[model samples]
Target: MSNSLTVGVVQQPAWPDKARSLAASEAGIRAAVSQGAQLVLLQELHATHYFCQYEDPALFDLAEPLDGPTGQRLAELAKELNIVLVGSLFEKRAAGLYHNTAVVYDRAKGRVGQYRKMHIPDDPAFYEKFYFTPGDADDERGQGFTPIDTSVGRLGVLVCWDQWYPEAARLMALSGAELLLYPTAIGWDPNDDDAEKARQKDAWTIIQRSHGVANGLPVLVANRVGFEPDHSGVGGGIAFWGGSFVCGPQGEMLAHAGEETQQLVVNIDMARSENTRRIWPYLRDRRIDAYGDLTRRYRD
Candidate 1:
C-alpha cells in the first residue's frame, strides 16, 4: 500500500448566518474530495462568524451539541464523500457549560473523537474567557492526547490557542500520532500596522512548523479568513489572517496560503515521519527524568 495521504484545508471567511456558512463549507469539502483529498479540515468555528471579538451573552446561543445540525451535516458530508473530516465547533456540553472543541468524523466510524481547546485566549479583541471555560484535561470519553485512528491515519487533533503549546503537540506525538491537526481561528487587530500583522502571522506559522520538526510528524492548520466585527460594538474587531498551511515531518512546508479565500489541498507522505524520526532521534534523546518543572505554573 502507498504510504501517503492527500489532505485538504478549507480557508474561508465565516458569515453571520449559520446556514450560509455551513453551505459554503460543504461546497469547500466537496471541492477537496473531488481533488482526491482523503482527509479534510475546516477552520475553527466554521459554522458562524468569529464571535470571540466581544463579550456577549447572546452569542452563547451559537453553541450546539456535537450531534447537532452542524455535526450531522458534517457527518453526512464525510459519509457522502467517503473521507475523514476534522472540524471545529462551539460545543454546548451542558446547560451553561460551553467549550471550544475540535471534532473528528470518519467515513466508516461516524464520530471518531473531539478535543476541547485546552488553552483559551482572552486578549483585547479575543474575549474567549468570557465565552468559554477552559477545557478539561480529558474529553467526556476520558482521553487526552488520544489520536483518532481512521482510514486515513492517526490524527492528533487540536484547536486554536492549543497550537502555541509544544507540550500538547508532544503528548500527541507520544501517543502515536502521525499528523497534527489544528482547527484555528486566529487574526490581527485592525489597528495594528502591516509589519505587526506580518510578524504575528509568521510566528503562528513557524511555531507549529517547529512542532512538526520536533516531533517528526506532519502539521496542518486551517484558519478562518476575512474581517469580523465585534457584535456588541465594543472593540474595533479582528481581521482573521487566513494563511492555512501544511508541512512535512522535516519542517519543510509543502503548501501555504495567502491572506484571502482559498481551499488548499496537499499530498504528503505518511511514511516519511518514521524515517525522519530515525535520523533525528529527538524522541529517543528526551531526558524525561530531569524535566519536573514543566508541571509548575512558572519556574520563578
Candidate 2:
C-alpha cells in the first residue's frame, strides 16, 4: 500500500427528501474526487433528516434493507468515481429490526463491508434507541468491531454514538485497523448558551482526537451541518455544529471545517502511525491480563 492516503469528508445538511439529500452528498463526493481524494466519508444518515429527534412508528417506513436504493447509489458512486466511499443508512434488517449502519465501497468492487452503530444514544433530542436495534455482537464474517478491508486500507468504521467509547477504538486498533473513521450527526440544543455550546463541541473534538493519539492512527470525522428543527415539538431543534475534521497519527489537525456545508480533503501519512507507535508504544505496554473487568456492566 502507498505510504500516503488522501481522504475527504462531506459535511452537509440533510433534508426530509432522500433525492435532495443524496444530491447534496453526490455533489460533495464529486468535489472531493476532483481534488484527488482516494477515500471519502459521508455524515451519518445523509439520506434523510434527523428524524430520530422524535419517535413515531410511521417513521420506521424510512428504514430500508441492506441492498436498498441508498446503498445501491453509494456503490455506483464508488464505481463511477473509482474511489473508496463510506456512507450511512437506516437499515431494516427484518420485521421490526433496524440499525444505524455504515457501508463501505471500494472502487469497482462495489459494496465491500459495513459496520452497525453499536452505541445507540437516547438523549433528549437524540432518540436512536427507539429506532434502532443495537448491532449484533458478531457479523456473519467477523466480530462487531472488526475493521473492514478495502483497497484504500483497513478502515475501522464506527457510527455517531460509537465515537465516544475508547474501548471501541481500542478494539479496532487491536484488530489491525489502519484508520479510524466516524460518520457522526451530533449537535447542540439551540437554546444552549455560547459557552455551553463551545464546551460540547470542544469535548467532542478532544475525545475523538484522543482516540487517534491513543491508537496511533489517523482519524476522520464527517458531521452534518445546519439547524434541524424538532417537528415533534418536544424540544428545541439541534443546530449541528459541522466542525468536521481530519487528524493525523499524533492528534495533529490536518484539515477542519466550520459550521457550514463544506468538503474537507487532506493527505494522511499512513506510515506515521507506525513511526509514532514506535516512539510511544501504548499498545505494546498494555496490561491485557489485568483488564478482565472491562466486560462488566459496573464495578459495583
Candidate topping lDDT: 2
For residue 232, model 2's alpha carbon misses the true position, in angstroms, by 1.2
- What tens-digit string does per-residue lDDT give for candidate 1 at 1-300? 259899999998898899999988998899988899999999999999988887779889999999998999899888988999988889999999999888899996788888888888989888899888777786657356677777788889988888999999999999888899999998999899999988999999999999999999999999998989888888888889998999999889999989888888999998899899899999999999999999999998
Where does candidate 2 have its weakest 10-residue lDDT segment? 134-143
Model 1, residue 59: C-alpha shift (Å):
1.1
TM-score of each: 0.97, 0.99
Clashes of 2: 0
Error of 2 at 170 (Å): 0.3
lDDT of 2 by residue, 1-300 (tens): 799899999999999998999999999999999999999999999999999999899999988987899999999999999999999989999998999999999999998888888899898989988999887788677649999999989999999888889999999999999999999998999889999999999999999999999999999999999999998888899999999999998999999999999999999889999999999999989999999999999998
Return the TM-score for candidate 1, rounded to 2 decimals. 0.97
